[model samples]
Target: MNEELRHQAYAQLEADADRIVRLIKVQMDNLTMPQCPVYEEVLDTQMYGLSKEVNFAVRLGLVDAEDGRELLEKLEVEVSKVHDLYMQEEKLESKEI
Candidate 1:
């Protein structure tokens, strides 16, 4: 792939990651427990979409397979942090009630 296409693919990948992270944060903010089934469904769908994009980028020579995996890994780490925050909020709310 040309440099421009490669740059575009990388930008898309980063944008997708940011979008999902923002979605997760919004869901957490709006939901009481952050354990809604619908939220999980949406998250799963978003994650799958991101994976497909990464695969396409790899096939197009826009990004290496290992780098794509690393990008996904970073997203997972962000998700884990959000989950931990949700759990902490739940615990604090429970203590008040």
Candidate 2:
């Protein structure tokens, strides 16, 4: 692949990862609680979709395997942080009540 194509692929992957993180943040902020089954379902769907996208890119040789792994890892960490924050807020609400 040309250098520009490789760069674009990587950038697109990064943007998708960022979009997932933002979605998690928004979901936590305004939608169901983290413990809700709906929340779990949404999270699972989003993660699975992103993984499929990464796999497709890897198979196409648009992105390196290691980079794809890293992208997923980083997104996982970010989503974890969002979940943690919601959990913490729940705890604080319970304590206040």
Query: What is each predicted model's overall lDDT from 0 to 1?
Result: 0.89, 0.90
RMSD of each: 1.4, 1.0
> What's the CA error at residue 29 for candidate 1, in Å?
0.9
In model 1, the worst 10-residue window by lDDT is: 31-40
lDDT of 1 by residue, 1-97 (tens): 5888888888889999999999998888886355678888888899999999999999979998998999999998998899899889889999999
Q: Give the TM-score of candidate 2.
A: 0.93
Residue 24 in candidate 1, Cα distance off native in Å = 0.7
Backbone clashes under 3 angstroms, per model: 0, 0
Give the distance in Å from residue 85's predicted Cα in candidate 2 to where it truly belongs. 1.3
For model 2, the stretches where C-alpha displacement exceeds 4 angstroms are none
